[model samples]
Target chain A: MIEAIFEKFFQHYNFWAAVVIIFIGIYATIAKNNLFKKLLGLNIFQTGIFLFFISLGDIGSLETLGIGDATPPIIWKPAEERGYLYVNPLPHVLILTGIVVAAATTCVALALLIRIHKEYGTLEEDEIIELEAIRGD
Target chain B: MINTVVEQFPALIVTTGVFSAFTILILGLLSRKICYYIVLIVTAFHFILSIFTLQHVLTKGRIHYWFGGWRPPWGIEYVVDELNAYSLIVILFLGLLGIIFAKRSVEKEIEERKLPTFYTVMQLLISGCCGVVVTGDVFNLFVLAEVASLSTYALIAIAGGKALRASYNYLILGSIAICFYLLGIGFLYAVTGTLNMIDMRIILQNLYENKMVHVGFVLVLVGLGIKAAVFPLHTWQPDAYTYAPSAVTLIMSTVVAKTFVYALIRLIFSVFTVNFLELYINAWNLVPWLMGVAIIVASILAYRQNNIKRMLAYSSIVNVAYIVLGISFFNSQWSLSGALVNILNHAVAKGCAFAAVGAIVYKTGIKDVGALAGLANKMPYTSGALLISMLTLIGIPPSAGFVTKFYLAIGCLEMQNYLMLAIILLGTLLTLAYFLRVIEQLYFREGNSTQKEEVPFSMLAPTMFLAILCLAIGIFWLTGIPLEFLKKSITSMGVIFR
Candidate 1:
């Protein structure tokens, strides 16, 4: 049982790594008080998701099918003739879109943070709330 | 030739929005005043196109346009069935009215230089909403939802001051929500190996017992629940609604929220289907209970708010719960139709209410509910519009809200869910209590000023139009004129009307 568990863990370590990184990012986003830190945490969280998606494309070796190595998703004459296995490229394309969305979200968030800092002269969430309370908004 | 071109309307609608957004931005460099006109023209065009799309859908059946002629499951697709067509019409209709109302309000609230970009983002937001409603690809829905959300955040922040904080908080929560949705999509794709919603639905049938499918189902529900502001995940709504510009508040509270709910419905009915819920998740049994909590809690919260906008925002949550509750009783046809009709009803009622409140804020700068006393004498038309909308929201007879409640009550009877029925009744009373406060203030008490100060004709027209629509739709529903359309849309989702 122990040996079987070890083999499974080694085989799917990418998913386990993604799980750990995702939790860390969530913790930082929730636990951190600094707005900038929170944004950083959000980025980390998204990056973890991206990693999870990318790993899903990687089909490991299948000795029964005589595919020992997985190549990148490229369609060339020699690779096709040689029966080369190609990693799924759809997830990569989806993640590329996701990355652009993430960048846009970060840019908007950063702009809002700048405006918040300019308005309240602070970057801490609690301090900003306090200032808002004192001002009676 | 015309038939072929009409087939391409789905893609044209969204492309017009994205292209117009940039066009406005570039053209505004030379002439800023023209931006509003461009938005008005484009939205008008979109509204007309949506009408054509709906007419074609009703007659010709579902329209599918593959992106660049790549077939489904391999390339992105735009499918406008009865549901999408209905939602598209409602979205663009409200969007056009909101833009018409925006002319005077935007000029007043936004800085002169920001006007061009403001219109640009507004166009993007509309297009994003159109994309969300029409697209058949789940990942495409996520991307377009992000586009809409990002524009919303920018629009709210453009108001400056307290709005910045509201927008920031919304950004954090909204991004997290969309990421969860993306994760859910990833899980489904990992298992099913398909991104097209129809393909995924077929593949998900056999995989319902899989743990990953179950987790993906829950994740998607939670993610959309936040976006739709379903009771527990609604922390960001009140602030965003209260601080956003009047036009933004109107559009967000009505069109934006409704589109998300439509997406949720599409995912539940079309993508996952009823069999999945019946077999594994038993979500039909679960969602109504949560919606019951939302109805009671959100109404009470709405009652306690001092600011009128904030109160309306909470009320918006209550109405959202109503829609969810209506659909959750999946066994009852009355309930499903009630939910679909309520989407149009609530949009008209709430859009009118927010526009009136915005006009009040525009002229008098009064945010407190108590300060509304005696303004009726000065702003008669505005105050009258507010009264009608508040009445409609309280579900009085011969108004839009009444139609929804009557159908919902009949639905409850059909399902024999007495507890939900009582909750609905109690919710109505609570709604009456809060709205009566505003109505009483509008007509009963004396104001400090007596001078007539109605909003511009541009703003008043749309508010009045929506208020009239509230009564007209109620009467329309009573006459059962649109029952065929409603039944067609609901039945097209593979739901049997017993």
Candidate 2:
């Protein structure tokens, strides 16, 4: 019964999850005062897309019904042991790469932030920009 | 086995370039001046690959090698036809020249502590460029482009000062450009169901009428145009080139922008047919015309500059316009030839010029073009190289730039595109006007109180070496191996301009 409800809800919820993640990411990036927050937002936004892709890979997870009270992903354990198969593996691979790239990029961004703080004596983006402006003048 | 080896000459050459770049990146970490050795080793390896590839293509024909032997539509591929092989040689040759020049030039601007990091970024940048040229996958191009861009960003930041801000601006704009590219790729993937360009071409040909695909192409064009620093989207380049470490300028000015522009060409001509863009010709026709205007505006802008580096930045903007304008001619033989040869010519000539200018900056700290009085006496070889590169920049006969312009003019004339020819002529005149001013300043003036140090021996040697290449390409055309191959490759190409 729960599985059926999830199947019905998932087809609709997948897009919302992506949209919400993207919104929160953008909001933090643009609206937040802290540079660190903006970076976090960017990560959230990036991960949101990652989730969307994962959701895409899970498009058919609900179709493998009536496995008679077995555990998930029971592949070839003699007849009755079989339950629902796992989602597609390709998006998982792509998302894995994305995660690695994201991690590297975030590390760089954070390092830049730290340098900006050390040089200008602040972690706020606007303050840093202002300091840089004074230096330019 | 021998036949297969011969058949895959182009692929091997490209991969060899890529592999050499990686090797340099790893091994370049050791020792202080070790980066120089790594660059030399890699460039030598790439140079040999270039010769063999060019010879193979000339003798046999088009060389297409599939990755994992999967054929098109289902598998990725790498192609080195006339266009690919030509640009590959241009990219690699200039890359070699750049590394050689950079040995002394880079060591000057870059502090000892940052030297290893500099070489690592350069290797990544070169490999990224090489990958852009050789890859047949559209998405793969975007990935490689970032590989180039991220390193380019870091390299620019090494210069300090407003270098960070400039790099930041570049990062923002570059991020937007890459995102545009990725978004466009997503759209393309949605439509074609394949990332391999040859496969995409097959699918796109069938769906040429699709509106979304048309939009995808425009997105790609815009994205790449920004990356290539074409005209309107070229704001980041001046700052990046001006503020970055001097050797970085040499590499960026000569190769990075040109690689992306060529990738743009590869997409339109090889991945999408002329018929497709033609259907929307009325809409897209402005692309070439805008390029024409960029040629004019950028040259004029070059002439208006105070800083020498900024002037060359604008001048490079003009050079990119020529390459792009060539693309707009569709399959026109003369235009394409002009565009193609200009690519190689500019690489050699501009590389020499930037190195010479950087050497000047290294010696006496003169960035302003107007007040640099009496520099020649103390730094004769450096100034002499400056003069030759200037002459070459002006497309003077027996110079590298001369041969390139000659071919480009022929391209314009063959198409009856007289306005483009006029633009070319005007651009050359403007180039002469700006560059000759520098020559006059250098050779005429005796000395100023501020002009303190003699040019460094390390810096002057490379400048003189590059200046020799500029003169030798024009004066000693018969014996120059690179030039000889250029002529052969241009002739062997199957595409006819008219």
Candidate 3:
């Protein structure tokens, strides 16, 4: 039980870390007052997603079907004809593109935020919404 | 040497188009003014390459260009079949027309500095789209889809804050869709141990009842459905179209999004094959009946919209449902032809309509459909062209819309689908009701009493050219249609099973 607990703690560590980061991003996105902070939250949230993807793809180090055996992921023994499956390369492929997309979206969002600030003289979302209402565009 | 070149010809041509576009983009980044003309030249070269693929595909059985010469069920492949050839021609031609219109509209709407980068992004979008259609590997399809989408998000946001908001919303939803597709692809890849589409299909056919396969199919369909703007997942399209810069909106509405939908058609029909579709039908007549609902509902929704762009957006949804209906009644030659022709019919007619509306918006800054009074007097050629397109949208006689609608009705009838026929007819009337409302104001309204001013020739020329195309196509179809071979091609895709 102790080893299991220790291994669980060590294994999905990055996943949990990402989850925590995602929570912080969500909080910032919702509760923070600044527009740039909200954007920061969005960035943080996307970063968490990227981290989760990368971590998920590397979980082959701990095989679920191993059932507590200290076997490496190789067919070395005659009985061990099939070794454990390696980490999925697919998610890494997915996240690599996701990271690039996240960056592009961030650049465009920041540019729009800059334009919004220039036009309305305020960076707050509520203030901008009010300005839009007044101008009725 | 000849066999090697012949073996790799499809990939070479497809890549040539793709790389040339990328080269133009890079050059444009260094110098924007030069990029504008270069983009046109690059696209023209791509068109020539597409013609070569067309010739080869027509002569040969199918052009299968295995990636790095690695055989299928292992490495990626770029397959150019007759279906791909037809869709390639339509999509690239639309991109050509859209970019042509874009050259002038962009200069007016976008600032002086952003034009070159915008062209680069547009080229990237086309490359991504072409990659999606031609790739014989499923995983590569997803990657290409993202490449297209990433560039699209940037292109859409170039219109400024409202477009920015639209892009942000689009990014969120689009990401979810892509994630779902990747997860589905993961499932498929794990189960079959293959990424090549044809090999996977053969294997999947043997294991049709596998739970993972079912899950994968549903996920991929839903994912692609969102991209294709299927009835339920189409909320992002209108705002994205409306808030976008005129040039951006023109290309996106006319070409980019339509290419995605066409790719969805190939994935669903070609990959899944007819038996899988039959499985949906036997399981509570799912495909056909669901499509019947989509057609009726989407058309009614289109009839009710007030914003011009929103109306067109809803019309796109309604039109997409018609294509899905082809799947429901699978293997009907007429139905498939109707669905296939709708791709061109809608793109050409709507591309021109949006261009005309965009010109009107540039002149008056109006967004509401009711504001189109006496537009004929002010912008004669544009208004006249839009009027004709609206007629096409309404499926009036002697228009391309009529030709396609005729096939769809004939298709539904041949399959003994009366209820579907009734619904399509009803939708056609609803289409007429909305379009005629626009036409009535343009012609008979008293808003023309005042003096009218004309816009620049730059705006008028594109609309007039497309308007001529609309008339020429209708006349050509009347004078015995030249696309009989297209019918044979559709039949070859198991459309004649019934």
Ranking by lDDT: 1, 3, 2
What local lDDT does model 2 show for residue B269? 71
Compare the candidates by TM-score and give the number of the best one. 1
Q: Look at candidate 3 and give me any clashing residue pairs.
A: B331-B495
Interface RMSD of each: 0.4, 2.6, 3.7
Q: Estimate TM-scores for all models.
A: 0.97, 0.82, 0.84
lDDT of each residue in B237-344, candidate 1, tens digit only: 999999999999999988899989999999888878777887887656878888899999999999999999999999999999999999888778889988999999
- Sequence-dependent TM-score of model 2: 0.82
List candidate 1 segments past 4 Å from native: A61-69, A73-84, B1-3
lDDT of 3 by residue, A49-101 (tens): 67765665554543553623333344354555434344556567767776776
User: Rank by TM-score, descending?
Assistant: 1, 3, 2
lDDT of 1 by residue, A1-137 (tens): 99988977777788888888888888888889999898998999999999999987775433223545466656444654544457878999999999999999999999999999999999999999999999996
TM-score of chain B taken alone, candidate 2: 0.89
lDDT of 3 by residue, B1-498 (tens): 124344455565457656766677677667878877877776766766777777777776677776766777666788877777767777777777777778777888898787767887788787777778778888788777877887787788888766766675576567556656765666676567677888887787877777877777887888888887777888888778877877677777767777778767777666677787676425525666777777677777767877787777777777788877765566577788778777778777888888888888877776777877777787777788888888887788888888777888988999898988988888788888777777776776756444665556766677777777776776666566546756656754544464
Q: Score the docking of each candidate (DockQ).
A: 0.87, 0.18, 0.25
